[model samples]
Structure formats: structure tokens, C-alpha cells
Target: MNRFAALEAFVRVAETQSFSEAARRLRSSKSAISRNVSALESELGARLLNRTTRSLNLTEAGRAYFERVSRILADLDDADRALGQLQASPRGRLQVSAPMSFGFLHLAPAMPEFLARFPEVDVDLSLNDRFVDVVDEGFDVALRIGALPDSSLMARRIAPIRRTLCASPDYFRRRGTPQTPEDLKAHECLRNSNVARTQEWRFVDENGKPSLVAVSGRVSANNGDALRIFALSGFGVASLPTFIVGADLRSGALVSALDRFVPQDLAMNAVYPHSRHLSPKVRAFVDFLVARFGKRYWDPDDGRP
Candidate 1:
């Protein structure tokens, strides 16, 4: 028999002073309650109650045990209640993992508003270019771009991430603008080494067909920001995410090339371990991300030219 169950049964019977009343409160039969109390007495080698023809009363040992265990049970109940409150309210540290560029450019900026809305939640945001095992690393949520592979994790699409092929006006003026995808071969292209095929750029042709071109340049870097900087200084054309280049393109510091050949947009996703029983902090942060970026914030207008 479970010692805790037996103790609970004895406490209930002693408090009620009636086996039948205790059974009713516990939603069990009187015989079961009597047996539990009997088991508790056998386990402890002590009789806990005196049963008379018309009444029941706790013995000296029973009264003392009841006083101590009842307080312990009450404290356990209070602990459970406190944990339930923490689960119900967003009032704890929320550990998040995200890509370095996206985290710094987008998530870092929006954090003030998120904290203002959920003043109770504290955020521990970790940014890195490398992928992390969220469960192993103890992260509550992670942000990813593009489609996720088959996994036990759940994902929600937050926004669209569009990539743009761009270069500074001076570079385009010096190198001459390429009218067709094949023309890119003659021009230098700054590459981001993180891509699977750094030399290859994919696009959709004017006929809505897939097209690819092998590109090479003097500079190649693992960071997108670095590539963007090189492209800005008139070094070479670079393919970069709209979030990184959108402002520069709008400000005319960078001009987009081959707009007609823009590829399909990738998705920004908030990924978590489980779909069910999501914590209040994670749910609130995800909802904030969706609401905060209901529309593509970077490309407020359809990117053209």
C-alpha cells in the first residue's frame, strides 16, 4: 500500500471522526478507508484510533501524527498551487535561441515592446549563426528560416523572408548592369560562405522556370552583414535577405538587380519542442512575434527595381 495514501486516509478518518464520512469525502468505500487505516497501523506497528459502537476517536499517537503530517500536506498543497500559478502566468525566464543576423536585426529591436506587454516575463535570448539543440541546450523556443525537416518539434510561420540580389549604384555603374541571368557570369559576386553552394545563385526566370548561375568574386565571408557591407562599398553584387538590405535599398544606398527573377520567399518560423501544453511565456512571445510582424515589416512596399 502507498504510505502517503495510507497516511492521508488515517488523517481524513481522524479529522472526520467517522470512517463512512471520510470515505464519502475521498469518494471511496468505507471498507477501503478502514483497510487503509488498518494498513497504516500495521505498517507503523501502532493503533491510531479507538472505535466504539456509535463513535470513533483518535488515540494519543494518532493525534500527534495527524498534527505534523497535516501541516506537511498543507505545505505540499501550497507548493503545488504556487507552481500552477507560475504556469498560468508568464512570470519566469524565457530562454530563446535564434540566428545571429535575424536576432540582432529584428528580434533585438522588438524586445522592448514584448517586455512592456509581458512585464512579468524575463527573456534570456541567445543568438548564434550555428544550429542548436534546443532541448539539449535548455532553450524554450527557437527561431528558424525556411522549411523545417521532419521532426517531433512544432513550428509556426511568423513571417516571410525574401532574398534580394543587390549591389551599390557605383558598382553597377562601374561593372554595368546585367539584363539577363547569364550576364552575371561577367560580374563579380560577393558570396556568403554559409550557403551550401556559395558559388551558385538560384532564381526564377521570366518564363517562371527555375534557373541557377555559378558566381565567384574576390571576397567571401560567412556573415551576411559582411557580404552586405562589401556589396555596399561597390565591391561586388551580393544576394542578401530583405531584412538586412531593405533599408539600404530604400535609402538608395543599395540598388536591387534582376527584380524579375526574384525567387520564392522563405518562411520565418518559431519552433518549439511540443505543440501541446505550451508555457504561457513561450505562447505570449510567439503571439507577440506574429502580431508584431503581421505584415512584412522590412518590405513595407513591394520591392521593385
Candidate 2:
């Protein structure tokens, strides 16, 4: 017999002081209940009940074990109830890792609304441009941009991350816009140091064939926002995500360079440890992000942008 089942039957029989009453409460046969209690007593090497013709009674040993076992069962039930409640509602501290620039410029603004929708959840957000191991770092979820490497973790695409070669209007006016990918060689390009090929910028032609252009820049920074600021200050052209430069492009603070040569659109993905049985907080947040950004709302061509 299962230990838990036997213990439960023993506890119920002790409480009601009658096998018939315990069986009725448990919706089981009285003989099955008696057998379970007997098995439990045999396992414990002690008599648990004082059987009589008229009434049932608990032995001293039975009474002692009942007190402790009843408390344990109650606590177990409470824990199960708590877990069910948590599954039903997103409540608890959700640990998240995200890129510094995107976190501040995008996610930070959307968080207030998410919190408003799920008031019981608190977000513990960490912003850094470095790659974080979602499982090893103990993050409940992570937002990543670009092509993801092969890993054990599961990912869900949240938005399209479109890259554009752009510069501030002042810089473009001074240097003139690059009409083609090769033309960028003559311009003072600002490089994002984080990329694998710091000096090469990629673009796709009209035929959808991708090409890499070798270029040099005076300013190179590891962080995208730093490169963005340099471009804003009219330093040079930079390849940046539309999510970062979309507002500027709309406001005429920046202008798209080499518009004919389209850059490949990457993806913004929400990564977690596993796909199955995800916690309520992580699932809610990822779903929220998908609904909020999956349509590439940051694109200048988008009506809202």
C-alpha cells in the first residue's frame, strides 16, 4: 500500500473513531479502510486501534502518531493549496535579464502597465549588454536580441529586431548620405564594438542577397546606446536596431542611410530554462511582450511609429 494513502486512512479512522464513518468520508469500502489502517499498524510494529464490539478507540501510541500525522497532512494540504493559487495567478518576484539599451528604452516603459495588469507580481530586472546564462544565472526569464546560439534553454520570439544603418541629420548633412553599401567606406562610420566583426557592416541587396561592407570608424563602443549617443552627437554613422533609433528617425533627429540596401531583420526572443510547465510570472511577462511588440511597432513605416 502507498504510505501516504495508508497514513491518510489511519488518520481518518482515528479522527472518526469508526471504520464505517472513515470509509463514508473517504468514499471507500470500510474493509479497504480497515486493511489500510492494519497495514499501517503492521509497518509501525504497534497496535493503533482498540477494537470493540460497540465502539472504536485509539491506543496511546495511535493518539501520539495521530497528533503529528494530522499536522503534517494539514501542512501538506496548505502547501498544495498555495501552489495552486500561485499557478492561477502570477504573484512573486520574477527575475529577468535584459540588454541595457533595450531594457531602458523599451521594457522599462512597458513595465508599469504590466504591473498594473498583474498587481501581485514584482519584477526584478537586471540590465546589462553582456550575454547571460538564463539557467546558470538563476534568471526566470531573459530578453535576447540577434541570432541565438544552440542551447538547452527554450526561446519564444517576442518581436522583430530590425537593424538599420543610420546617422544623425546633422552628420548626414555634413558627410552626405551613403547611396550604396560601398559608399560607407568613405564615411566616418561609428562602430558598435560588441559585434563579432567590428569593422564590417552587413546589408541585403534588392535581390535579397546579403553582403558585408568593410568599413572604418573613429568611435567604437561596446554598448549600442553609447554608439547611438555618439551618432546623435553627429560623430558618424552607426548600425543600430530600429527599436533604438525609430523615434529619432520619426522626429527627423536621424535619417536612414543607404535605404536601398536593406539590413537583415533579426529577432527579439524571450528565453527561459524550459518550455514545459513554466511559472505564471514568466509566462505572463513573455506573453505580454509578444502582444506588445510582435508587430514591429518601432518601424518608421508603421502607422504608430
Candidate 3:
């Protein structure tokens, strides 16, 4: 191993205090990281890392060397960032991921314009519903929805979203409209199988007490858009995101049930690894999304219906 390469690995190990964590962050294997550190120790003739089965520590010499090398590495990173910023154009292949149907309906429409605006960027976008390992799989950014799992990944809200309880006027006319959250239990509801528990639909009561209503349905679908279509055809009551059903609600094609008990908030987020220096391309795309679709995306009073 080269001198500075070993120093970099040693510094990461020292900072993270785990060879495995340092390896994960560096996108290398634990054995490779351990081997590099050992090679550094062999070349310097001084053991830099004090390792154990459970923990790691830096030797006295390693501490002093770390104090000096940290500043050098910081300077190099700053210089690299500075030079990267100086480039007049962003020129690289940027990989992005998003949900399948949303990518088709919203994201895809804007891409041609974005491409025209930035000739230097070549975007590689992957559309799927499943969560992807961005760092391991080499994605630069991922557009996410609903509750994000706690992780090192960074997220920014691109728009607002809420799972609105909706039914067609025809169904409501026949079955009678629900006046309160409790009434949903008696109604015929279409379940979203994608939800964690298909049998329960959650809502916040008037006092802000959280409640789950056990709902039953004859037809359940994994796709939100399909469930929405079924609801439109007077199949049953369906709860779906505002972005998916907002326009229909405004046009009177779909009407909300138990509107008073509905939660008013959720978010559409742009997620990426929580790196100190995020690329301008990712930053640009998120800003573009926010500018295009803002906080009042589903405001019922808005003309979009």
C-alpha cells in the first residue's frame, strides 16, 4: 500500500473506531481495510491502530500523526471542492432513482426540458417501488415518499403529500357518506396492499388522538393508481396520496370521506447519502422539483382540481 493511501485508511479507522464501519463508508471490504492498515504499520515499523475484538484505539504515535494528517486531508478536500466548483459546466453521468408510476407521470415529463437546459449532464434514472441501496448500488440521488427509515441518507422535501380517504360520488350516494372516522368501519373500503397492514387505516381524531380503523374490502391492489381507478369506477372507498387523487377530488370525480379526521400533512422527499459535499446536479434537481411542485401542491382551493 502507498503511504498516503494507508494514512487515509488509518484516519478513517481512527475516526470511525471500527474497521467494518470505515470499510462501509469507503466502499471497501473489512479485510481490505485491515490489510491496508497492517501494511501501513509494517512500512512505518510502528503499529498505528490498537485493535481488539470489540473496540479499536490509536497508539500515542498514531494520535500525534493523526493530528497532523487530519489538517492535510482537510486541505486536500477543500482544494478538490474548490476546483470542482470552478468548472463552468457540470459534466458527468448522474444516476437517479424514483418510484415507477410517479417517474412516468411527473418526473419524466420534465426531463426533456432539464436535458435541454444542461447539455453537459447525462442522467441515468431508475424507476422502481422497492427501496434501493444508493451508495452500494452507486445511485447519486433517490426520490422517496412517505416515512423514511432512519439512516445516514440525507433527505429534502420536494413537495407535500397526504393519503386522502376518497370515494366516488356514486358509491357515496348509494352507501351514504361517512360523517366521522368511526363510520369508515361500516363502509366498504378498498385496501392498499402496499401499506404495512392492509386491514387497518389510520387517522387522527378531532382531539389529535391517533386511531386505526379496521377496514375490509373484496378487492385489494398493490398499485395505488389502480386502486384509485377502482375507486373511481365506484368499486369502494380508497385512501391514497393527495398527489394521486387531488385533481380528481377537485373535479368532483372523487369526493373525500371523513374530511375532518384526515391528516393534513406528509412530504415528498429527495434523498441521498448524507455526504458533506453533495453534487450540484442533485441539488439542482431537488430545487427544480420544489420550484415546480411546492408546499401547496394539494390545496383543494387551488384551480388544478
Best by lDDT: 2
Q: Give each prediction's root-mean-square deviation over alpha carbons.
A: 16.0, 15.5, 7.3
Q: What is the Cα-based TM-score of model 3?
A: 0.73
Q: Candidate 3: where is the Cα deviation over 4 Å?
A: 3-79, 86-88, 295-299, 302-305
TM-score of 2: 0.70
Query: Candidate 3 — number of clashing residue pairs?
Result: 1
Please state the error at residue 158 of candidate 3 in Å.
Answer: 1.5
lDDT of each: 0.84, 0.85, 0.80
Clashes of 2: 0
TM-score winner between 1 and 3, please give it.
Answer: 3
Across residues 122-187, which tens digit of lDDT does each residue of candidate 3 receive? 999898888897754668789888888897678898876766889999999999999887787788
**What tens-digit string does per-residue lDDT give for candidate 2 at 1-305?**
78998999998888777899889989999999999999999989999899999988888998888867876775676566655755588989998999999899889999999999999999999999899977535688999988899986789999878788888888888889888999998999888888799999888899889999999977899988888898889999988888889888888888887766866568899998753356778889999999988887778884432
Candidate 1 residue lDDT tens string, 16-57: 788998899889999999999999999889888999998888
Measured with C-alpha atoms, the lDDT of residue 223 in candidate 1 is 90
